[model samples]
Target: MVNEISNPAAVVDEETFSVRRTIRIAASVDKVWRAVAEPEHVSRWFGLVALDGAGVGATGTMTFPDYGVIPLRVEAFDEPNLISYRWGNDDAADARPDVLDPEKSTVFTFTLEPVDGGTQLTVVESGFERTSAPLENLESHRTGWNEELDKLVALVEGEA
Candidate 1:
């Protein structure tokens, strides 16, 4: 039987200019890591992810059906434990270039931990203060994480 973990929605902190969410999934750390770090599995739960390669500094694009493609780069990674991505969040940049704006991009880090029943995943997206619209973007991303992570939990757990 699968463990019923209560995953909460993402939270937006205006003072820190970030959004955070924690979820417990009934799956192994390796499995959960792939779901979040691998391009193929990431696309299944998040947006359509297309990455140049693995490891830090690898560039990529996540395309949402209505939102267009957002340029992203793997900022950091540590095996099946943690990974972070820096992505463009500038709404004014309608062109959606292939490069990330150092001034307008946000960094989102995913931390995974092994738990009693499965794995605990925490995602913190920061640097919203640098975005064109901090409040607007923060709220939007807060909602986005909640929706996205829920799908991630479902996908990983279902595969177990």
Candidate 2:
């Protein structure tokens, strides 16, 4: 059976260790899922590409031409709701402080919740044991997720 745990309310922000990052997006769950889950759609907004992962139990890859390609394995895929993945590649770029550990995969999750105006999308990335990889990765992703989230909002709102 899959083990699911509720995300903590507070994030860790220490010096030596801690792995937690959360960002919110403005869009419906369905819209966000479309913008993020599908390979074609994801390439248009989020990452460079979406490999095998499309539906539940899908495994593939995501890449950034400037950086490199990383293997992506989907774990939790609940349509129009949640999508989780393990990302990392063997390329040298994956060794950077900002990049995730290729040996130790990290968990990338998207949680959608309904709100007054539209859906609220929360992205939480954890499982960063390697300090160097998470360093630059965490900061870079901070901006990346925000931009991608906004793009998803635009795509969904425009369709509506």
Candidate 3:
């Protein structure tokens, strides 16, 4: 039997300055929602998330052990279906501001849909053109979404 999760690698669109990836997880939308929207669950698969508050307009940081803390904000949320976060994506910067810089931030939105047996999750990270190195950051985030979302699939599916 072939053992694989139906997840396509992330793609970087130069024209749009964005990275997009979609994956199917053997877990319900509710389960997947928690994994992506909750900071604790997100930290398990992605960066170490620390939000000052909850829901839209909340501001905080996601601390990656290797990459350090980056300013982040909850840009949008819609129950268990959608959640969008804007975070600093300036890969070439030597220092990061304590607050999210709208001009230099990229927003990554997670949209969840119910499927026959699980959930279809798609994440699109955009606004890379405003970052320091658009091309490099686009590719970096493209690779990042693949790795991070795969970890998320494992975490959510394992629990289900």
Candidate lDDT (C-alpha), each: 0.89, 0.60, 0.88
- In order of TM-score, best first, we have 1, 3, 2
Ranking by lDDT: 1, 3, 2
Task: Give the per-residue lDDT digits (tens) of candidate 2, residues 4-65.
Answer: 22222324333532334443344456666777677887887666765543665676667777
Error of 3 at 26 (Å): 0.5
lDDT of 1 at 159: 82
Clash count in backbone of candidate 2? 5
**Location of the lowest summed lDDT over 10 successive residues in candidate 3:** 1-10
Over all chains combined, what TM-score does candidate 3 have? Answer: 0.94
In model 2, the Cα lDDT at residue 14 comes to 33
Which regions of candidate 1 fall more than 4 Å away from where they truly are? 1-3, 93-95
Task: Give the candidate number with the greatest lDDT.
Answer: 1
Candidate 1 global TM-score: 0.95
Flag clash pairs in model 3: none
Instruction: Give the C-alpha lDDT of model 2.
Output: 0.60
Alpha-carbon runs more than 4 Å astray in model 3: 1-3
TM-score-better candidate, 2 vs 3: 3
Model 2 / residue 93 / CA error / Å = 6.9
